[model samples]
Target chain A: MRRHERHEMTEEARQELAAVDAAISGEAANGEHAPLQELVRALRGVRPQPSGEFLAALDARAARGFRRAGQEHARDSSRGGTARAGVARGATQKPRRRALLALPALGLAVAVVLLAILLPGTGGPGPQPRATNAPSKAVFGAAQAGPAVAPDRAALQPAPAPTAGPSAPGEQARQVERTSTLDVGVAPGNVQATAQRVFTLVNAFSGYVRQSNVNSGPSGQGGATFDVRLPSSNLAAAIASLSHLGHVRSENDTTNDVTEQVSSLQRSVGDQRAQRASLLRQLSQANDPQRAAALKAELNAVEARISQREGQLRALRTRVDYTRLALAVTPEVTAGASTGDLTPSAAAHDAGKILSAALAVLVIAAAAVLPIAAVAIAGWSAVSLTRRRLREQALDAS
Target chain B: MTLVAPRQLATPQQRLERLYAESREDLYAYLASLLGDRTLAEDVTALAFERAFRRRRLFNPRRGSERAWLFGIARNAALDELRRRGRSAALAGDLAAEESSREDHLEGVLRRTMVQVALGVLSARERELIALKFHAELSNPEIARVLGVSESNAGTMLHRAITKLRKACDAQA
Candidate 1:
């Protein structure tokens, strides 16, 4: 029964039944209780009491934050007023700066733009336009503005037919239907054949050789010259024939001074005939001395005029019959001049030409690089100005 | 005419908010006793509510009531704040020193004085366990969840701690 009761008794009952309960309660008390009690009193003494000033400071900070936030929101909405306000606030908060630094940057950009605008022609001092050495200037010679000398027409007048010799089969002179001159630079190897072919072709096409001059050049540098005449009717065909001689380099065509000659001749002939009739009449009436003297003086003056006019008309007709074509031909191969390897003089000429071309290209490249260099220099100037502005602001703020 | 707004506009919506509004003074006093620093106690208490509110969705209605869930979160938050302050600050006995200098005779009654003295003698962990048990009034399972231990182990640990407290008081006498 006692064992059964022991099992039923709880731990709480055991604690209450223990004899030392009063001792346990007192002895179990904390040892540092007095120190804790003392500390509680100290805490109550030292704790800061909240005051109005602290609250006011907090309110001010809140207002500043709210104003800043509102301004930012307004700026996002594009009101623009907020943007100005922000700039003002930023300026006040930021350090002071000088306005002068930006001037150099702006000046540099303007200078670059002006330089670009003026660049192509007068941006920098370049070489002057070189004087040209065109071969045409020497070849054609300058035209003068005066009456030209005419051929002696008395000699050009139709003479008595020559006593018969065997008539060359193609000897009949053909009318000049058309005319043209060819320019050809005689190359080596075909100069003689080329010259002969040009002459023969002009004749075959109803043309005639008016003049030919062969210049076997001074000291083995051989060349030929040809002054050919072709019928006016076949002038175009003769020009086309000569085009195949080598290469027709350039050409020009002009009419001779025949118009003035024909007009002067017709007037003088009429005057001479009238004067002759008058002289005959005077001679018939020989009883009158005054009429005889007047007719004699008139006949002398008319005779002089007639002689001048006849000469002009004959020269004009001769020119109309003959058309001159000038040709220059050089030997295709000069055995002594180019027999071996390239001559030193020829190599030197080629090298000079190449060097000139390369220099021209380099000059163009340098001109191109100048603008890029200017732009880079301008960019550096701008960055330097901005940095200087920042430094000045810092200094001013300090 | 513009209408004037009311001054006291507080309206409790959640369990944590209700508990905070209803028991703030008691909770602050209990935490101040546990932590010893008023500011630190206030910070930990406020942080506990913030976390409890954030995790309110995780509370199981079938497992416990709102009061128990909030208490669990608060108890854990308070203990975590103490642990992070480190062992030296925990053992400084600043709270015990503050409790002794009270001018109010009613606050310094024998029973309150006895409890205060007993708390000062206890370790930080023991004080936390006692707070969770009696002041925050969390159950053993709730305390275990806050402390990250099993329910049976929490009970056993509490029993051992209480037995030690009783023996220490007896020896002090």
Candidate 2:
């Protein structure tokens, strides 16, 4: 019977435990497990409390930790503040540095532009204007003036004569003497043939070869040079024909007027003739032998003067009517010449030409690049300044 | 009952002081229950407050109440202590022994002792849930947030833990 009673109590405990579980699981209210609820309430009431000393110690430790943390925070903020100040200073100075760098570059650019605008007007071997109607100061020989009178006085003071007729329209035309030099490249072994062709062409144009030379190089490559004078009217045709002899590597042409010189020489000739006529009249009327001899001597002197002046006039007229041409014929070898053909002197000459050309290019390049380099430097400085300022601004804001 | 003020208007230090004053006792109690030692619980409580003070700048009141946050820290401190003591193994041994030594009769004080022993029989996770629910007195959703689980999951786990505790208690009885 006692065993049955114990069993009944065990059943009651299990029922209460089930009710507690149900309440804790939210399936039932705490009011449904009043006995178990009461037990939980009592257990909670017995929950331990910390001692006063423990609470005090805990608060002290916490305060110490807080103090340390505050110090760290202060250190961090101070470092950040220093960094911010540095950024601010940099930002302020950046533009000034950029301006400093850019000022000289801008100045250089402006100077270069000014130079480019002003340089072309300064210097070169340009053609000079011809002086028309000027007397020729060039005296050919002492024979051109009588011995009895000073050469300068005689030439300066001409016998009083009727004013000369108005110059013919053709004579008044500006006389321009044209001359040219050409370098022609011909096939190897064809230099002589090309030179002969040039001679034939000159004769056809009523031109004369003033000087001619032909040579064969060690490699059997031949070359020829010619100084020729062509009628001025046929100059263009002569050059065209010479170009066909082979390939003209280079050509230069120039013109000069000698009309005033020609006219002056003609006047000198006329003066000499008048003086000779005066001496002849004196010779025919003279009675004393010594006077006749003196008059004859004056007449002879006047005639010699006339001849010299005539020669000068003829030479001037020849120069005015014909154009001089200098031509060089070089054999064009398709294959390399033998080493013997490349003389040290020839190589040095070539090297000198190349060096001079390179120097000229360098000078021209320097002139062209100076302003561009200045502008580029300025642009680079501006870009870098902008980037630095932006970076500094970001740092300051942070 | 001290009310949680709007922390947005308060400075970090003021917010921390207020959080301490309001939740210190409850947090201490929860740590004591979770760790099962008053001295260790006090140490953990101080450590938790220090950590909270250091990280005060990171606190957002919109996330949760100060109590939930403090308890979460306390839970981690308690677990760290438990690990340092190597008590997890001992707890597991005690749980196994209790499982094998089931009894069905007890009442009053013996019942309370049985309940306490039964709490020891629970797994660390079950114990943590029980502590957060009963000792920390956090609501199911607050417990979920602290434990990083869903509210329903937290509730379900709590219910299972309570059932196990009741069974252990009943078996001890």
Candidate 3:
């Protein structure tokens, strides 16, 4: 209260309280409030004696020294809730306080943790994942039991020399188009040699390279990428053989079921062949020139369609029979690597970029969590106040 | 309201024991009056002491005296019981019963009956105020602290309650 408000008692209130002492004490208040004094005396006499049984039970409990039963939250948490009690209750509320503080803090911590988890995801393409000095083994480890999981194949990952398709015994023949990516890091001066070894491995697995790009840097420092297609049955083994040439930095596998497309193309090809055979038999027996010409033209059109459909079917079959692999070979970063990009300044630049990214993530996390934490704290405080008010209002109610 | 040693000098257990020794009767009387049930008042009174003992370290003598603090706890416990029962404070069957028929005169019995009936005329809040003022014998400032009200507001409420009690008594007469 302000200085004046604390001392701003009115004369009427002063007189109203003048006999309060004498009246409550049941003494005569000089004939001014004699009636009030009598009532006070009567009220004082209204006290009823507690039964001896209850007193004995109470004395027994008190003798036992009151063991804690943890029913204290209702009474202990809000002890001395006034401002003056803050310093006093702080000591008493210590153990119970961690519970109150942790609730809101836990909410904020979850938000920041969620933001941190999403920091590296989906924001205009942050820097590509770099291959650092440390070698990592990150196979998705959640897929297994060997059912040629297309979508979940990236989950536990294929073992070395894995047979990762419906080609397994007792499985239905599921025509699938499979594509995989593997990034291998080789020691300096071995990129070109590694690229050659990859081609050799593909050939051993009866696969062919459709495209190859190798950048040969000075001092045997370079990188290579190849789009190779291997026989479907040998895909997993071929990758396993090729990965032995270098350190596998990253790997991904994907599959698409093309069973319906293959089936449709097969039906189209069969229909075209049947029609062409009928036209050939009719052309051999035709006698009229004009009619023959018409028949021949129709036959040619059907023949062309047959060839086109056959070509389409062949391509579809080829795709289903072979899995495409994109392999990238990069020089492993090392202390003795002969790349100019491995200089201290470049390392510092990379570190700076990474630091900047981490800071951005932290700032974004803070910005996201601050408002929520504010609302939570405000809500918690308001709820506590309302609950206390309601508990007090219980007296006014039933 | 007893003058005691420095709070810091004594352990919380010692202080609470002293508070119990000094104030148990008044505490029970105040609760029995507010709750209007001998058994319930006894239960809540014991509950108040147990609660007080469990939270002994929380008592800050700087805020108010030990009696006021104990009364505050007792009041809250009684109020909670009252709220749970979802009824007004009905005078106990034994509360207004005449005690010691041999020593009790007819005039005293009638006076006690009239006072008890007049008490039934007040609201639960008014009854609690009267209990605090008369049975607990708390000063207005101490009562204000226990009730979470300003000193003047407590004084005004007490004055109004007392005035109503007098009017109720006259009507009963």
Candidate 4:
């Protein structure tokens, strides 16, 4: 063999020798082998006989064993009587099923408690909706009077009266008029009184009513609105007096120059009337009947021009003589109502309370499930472990 | 000669004395080997007798003698005790004394030690195989019946185990 192969062979031989050596000094030497064999040989060498005391002890032990065997046989014969005794023992066992069954009941009770804690218990069923049988109210009635005239026709609606008295020096110094608005959470119940107050103030300053609305708001929240025309001369007094009705959220005053409009309309009206007079004069001097008829037609055209100019003058004068006061009246919310406690916040608080109650219910249900889940898991684990152990034991036996 | 009668009418104390005379040594020796402690051996011996006395009515004469049945019960009791305490080095001394009488003494001892170590290293199945073979001393056919394997397979496993033991001992040496 080559050097490496020879080395390998040597290692194998060494291993074989070691195995043989281990086999020679086996486990049997640790038991009764070497010593017992040596003792047997020594006893043969001495005289192949046991000592007197040793034999006597052995004989005595044998006799005692024989007597004991007899006793055991007798005991076996008496075992039939013991069967009756077992029946008596069975009667004394305690009733234990109640303790075992209480577990599920306990769990159910806990769940119920938790649900009670979580649920809002709104005390009783919510109130039933009451029936209402009121007749349907019309939103807007007809104007009630013809465009020309009627007995109940409004001469003038309410307006803001001027606040500035001639004796009040500060008001007298301020000639410019002003107007203001009131903002309320809900409109006030007295719409007519507010409108009348506005009209009286404007009238106090020699202003006239322009236009006003008595019923403005929806039925749920009562209020009204009005637009009054007051003289520019009385606008400042009207605004100051109207502010006394409620709080003014905003106010604004404007001055418009209608001097141009009035002068232009007046001049146009004068020119048209002059033309109509000239046409009528020309018609009297006509030589032919057809010429007179043509002159009459020219006079009618001039008369129409005069009427249009007069109407423009009237409208312009009406606007400048009376200023418009737009008034909005509403009920006051008081300091408490303005503190931001409406449906949204109330709903949010209710939602939070509802969520807390739901969480409580969930926690209780979880508590009820815990013990059962634990028992199931423990039993499963024990059974699985026992099965595994059985497999192991079978393998060991093999 | 007339055969002597059994002591059927003996008191509890007399019965206990008779039981002590017939079985004290054998029970102590077996229990000592099983528990690896003289004190535990004594206590277990007493307990086994008490249990046997209480459950004596269930004993059947057809299934081997009373002594063989009692030994079986004692074996079960010893195994139960071992399980309760968990497997520890305390039981090693008792288990080592079983096969300590053959010609291959040193080799057997080394193999046994290695087998114990191998038992710790094996999966539960392998450990159980080792326990049944040397500890329980069941024959190959009996082991095969218990394991649902053929007798030849059991024998092969036994051979393999012995080979492994020899190799382990050689390696240690």
Candidate 5:
């Protein structure tokens, strides 16, 4: 609606101005704008004129195309020129130089920022996204089997992620069931060698591979996985050694403490055993046939309880004695796998990693820049708006 | 089919020169009315042209016409001069006194005096509105562009100034 009013007013103003022009030139007139025409003619008569000398000088300057104005002003300024000359030079030169420098400056800033993000070993960490769905648990301390262990836990921590369970103070001899999963990659030919190395590595740690399914299929696109058990004390060392056999794609080592359960079962077995001994004694002391039969039945029941509790204790002990590892060895040709092991899936995975890295960098850069740019633009707009308002107010104030 | 020829474009300097030639007289008139001092108006006019020439390439035709752009610069310069002076355009009794003395035609002197009195009745902004409309020969939209105002507001202000001037002129007569 305001736009419509503006258009209407503009049309009226245009016609009024045309009528004023006609009135002044004595070509035509409009009846409605008689006063406006009279006023315009009076304004033209009262308008000021430049002296011939001033007009001639300005005309000559224009003929020269304003080219010599700068040189003349520069020379004048060197000789302590007029304030106008100095202002003119500053007005023209400063903004042009700034415009010329703007693009490279912005480009340099973005380049520096991207380099800070992308370059390795400049104290910037790689995008290490968590690539697993492991159960989230309390951040546990190191395997506190005691300070008597010899291997350097810190050095072994570089590969094969170790998920430690909390070991409270003075909780010694914990019956923990350790479990780990490892996804390792090897050269195609090394699948067999790497698998053999894995078994030998386990054996060296006094562990055994209980279930093995090693397949380098016809296309050689297959992998090997092992269900193995190692001594709880040697679990970390075994994982570290296994990781050295190939590119450790992913690894998770988790531990479960079942010491209290084991202790409860042991107590139950002891109680049952004592009950059995007492039942037999009562059986021997029985004077009547019915009494002897009842004592014998009680003895049998005690024996059954003892046997059940003992079986539970044994199974728990087996878990405490060894740690289970699920190790999957996928064929990795580019990492020295035989030519047959190369698969489009592997190449695509690599390409995906590169793409993900690029995307992460771009995201980080955008995250860093967009907010500042938005603030700058907003601030600039606010200042421009305020400045314009203030300039218009100057007219009112005058 | 008629053959069409590619139009040659003028260089920026050439264009600036053309605008200077066309608008210099009226621009000076507008500045003189706006400032009410001949010497200051001259200096401001020169300065405005210099600034326009320096910043000619900065002009975007899509935003406004060349004349509007030039007048906008002049308006800013004249306004700055006003702000610096911290007073209204010194349109005191002496300017009218001097004008009446310059003319020998008695009837012309009387008419100019009446017009001068009518103009003097306007406020500074109203006087600028009139100067932009008549002396600068700017259309209302051009006035709006120069003054950084909406077209409707410029039209309303122009109408009000014209009405006030008419009343003042009638009373003077």
Candidate 6:
């Protein structure tokens, strides 16, 4: 039927039908339409009812259904509790997983830092002496070349010894030039004595005091500064001895390898000498005075070049054989001294150093973690988006 | 069975059990009228009750009485079974056997057979309306809610359905 026509029955007609329906069901109705009432009566009388056996079966089935529903409710409640507990466990484990993932990165960073600290030739810029321990062709060649090339070079080479086996690259000794600075605090009365003791120790180690300066204040607070050079073999023992003279405030040690530099210098010296020898031979054979003079002057220039290279090589060898030590001795303040004696600038300097170190660590850690976090977030988003799209497609199919 | 308790406060399940006891016979009759097979009616009635019991938590007393809600479920169940069987024409074989097996008076049996045959002449929707009206005994407004239509529309449709059944019965006579 059309939408508008379905409900077109008048109120009066509806009331008549309702009355007929009431009469058919045995309720009080206006006494009209006897035949229509009879038909409704017959229809109502024939209404079907279930047999007794069917009713018994229905009751049994309904009871079972109720029992099943109750069991499902119990199971759901238990599952809910288990899910909550699992969520709690997962929350606690999340950070531990992050820590576990971070372990290798952290280890890598620590290894980089320790390598920078412990390896030679990887320190701040400073005056680097020659390295005595490394094998150098210059030192060996200088030993054969004699005193005319360099007066000090012969003393720097080791005595000739019998060989055991051909040296491998891995077994080659690194030519490291060691330098250190020490700051020590001593009793005001002991400052002069400490300087004398350091001087004596250097001399005993076949070392020499390069410079020494002592100053005393009007209140008898005195300090001394010493610049010394010591044989490399005695460097550690001298430093230990100096440390006992006072409370050692601070120390810094650095090493520089100069094996390649010495080798290059020796090669240059050899080339210059060959050039000088050729010039001298050309000068001796020249008959013309101008040509002879030119050859002689050129020979002079080559000889001077050779001498200059030999001098440089000699200096490098001496430096490689010795270690430099810069020591500062200051009057110590007693524990009972006034607070005014403390230096605020020094304390602030130390604090700044600590802050910078902490900042460096944070930057390194961030560099390691940020990339991994970004990749993980991107992967999770992609998977989630794909899952949502697939779910939408499945719903559309259904 | 005595389904009504005169004096007691009852839980929701208890209330549902009482409704089930009170309405099971009528609901079975409604299903039989709608589906036209005694066995199918019993099966559909049980399925409808099981569904009602499962979804009882969603029931609101203010919506309609338990009887209307149950009949609505039974109506859907009967239609689903009919659709599954691919037989929307009418009850034929089992209904004939049931009528022949009846020990009642011959006139009463003939009247029932005529009524069943008249019901077959109506469309499925018309037959459902007639069953809800006479067998389930739901009011116009309750039937409207169960069928998801306006009360006036439910009454009009039911009236038209009854007129069709009356015409079919007269022709058979």
Please compute DockQ, using alpha carbons, for every candidate against the native two-chain complex. 0.01, 0.05, 0.29, 0.05, 0.29, 0.15
lDDT by residue (tens digit), candidate 4, A161-243: 33442213564432232343433222233344455555544564566556666664444465667666666554554455455
Evaluated at residue A259, the lDDT of candidate 1 is 47
Q: Higher-DockQ candidate among 2 and 6?
A: 6
lDDT of 5 by residue, A1-398 (tens): 12224434556766765676576566645678777667776776677777677677667666665555655555646433454464356446756967765865596577657765666533322223233221111111111111122333343332332344223235455777778898877665556656665665676567899999998764358789999987765666566666655566788877688888989998998888888888888888889999999888888888888888898899888887777899998876554321223467756665666677667666666766777677767877997677566656666775
Backbone clashes counted, model 2: 4
Query: How do the residues B11-65 of candidate 2 rate in per-residue lDDT, one tens digit apiece?
Result: 8777677777767777876666665555456556766776687678887778777
Q: Candidate 3 at residue A4, lDDT?
A: 12
Residue B108 miss distance in model 5 (angstroms): 3.2
Off by over 4 Å in 5: A1-18, A24-26, A30-36, A51-182, A186-190, A196-215, A218-221, A225-248, A251-327, A332-356, B1-8, B37-40, B84-87, B91-104
**Which rank order by TM-score, best down to worst?**
3, 5, 6, 2, 1, 4
For each candidate in turn, the TM-score is 0.28, 0.34, 0.63, 0.27, 0.60, 0.42
What lDDT tens digits, residue by residue, belong to model 3 across residues A1-398? 11112334567657756676777655578676666666666665666666677567666667665544223323444542332132223224545866887887887888788877776632322223333211112211101111122222232232333345647655456788888999876655667766666665576567899999998786446899999998887776666656655556678989888888878888887898888888888889989998889989998998898888888878877887888899998877541212223577546654665687778877898798879878887988998677556656666663
TM-score of chain A of each: 0.36, 0.43, 0.52, 0.37, 0.53, 0.43
- What's the lDDT for residue A35 in model 5? 71
Candidate 6 regions with alpha-carbon error over 4 angstroms: A1-6, A28-31, A63-65, A68-398, B1-9, B89-93, B100-103
**What ranking of all candidate models by DockQ puts the best one first?**
5, 3, 6, 4, 2, 1
Worst 10 residues of 2 chain B by lDDT: B89-98
For model 1, the superposed segments whose C-alpha errors exceed 4 Å read: A1-398, B1-12, B79-92, B101-117
Q: What is the docking quality class of candidate 5?
A: acceptable
On a 0 to 100 scale, what is the lDDT of residue A316 in model 5?
A: 81
DockQ result, candidate 1 = 0.01
Q: Assess the local accuracy of residue A149 in candidate 4 as a C-alpha lDDT between 0 and 100.
A: 21
Please list the residue runs of candidate 3 whose C-alpha ends up more than 4 Å from where it truly belongs after superposition: A1-11, A21-42, A49-57, A68-174, A180-208, A216-222, A232-257, A330-398, B1-4, B7-12, B57-69, B83-88, B91-93, B98-117, B139-153, B169-173
Candidate 2 CAPRI-style tier: incorrect
- Residue range B1-173, candidate 1, lDDT tens digits: 11223343232233444454444444554565555655555444444455455565687767655665666555545544444333232322565555444446664444344455555567665766655555454556766665545655666555555555555444544
Q: Once model 1 is optimally superposed onto the true structure by TM-score, how far is the C-alpha of residue A182 displaced, in angstroms?
A: 73
What local lDDT does model 1 show for residue B129? 61
Model 2 chain A: which ten-residue window has the lowest total lDDT?
A134-143
Model 5 agreement with the true structure over B1-173: per-residue lDDT tens digits: 11222243366776777678778888887887887876666666776787788788998888777888998888777776666556468553335555665668887777788888888888877888888878787876788788777877887778778778889999978
Measured over all alpha carbons after superposition, the RMSD of each candidate to the real structure, in angstroms, is 31.9, 30.5, 10.6, 27.6, 10.5, 18.0
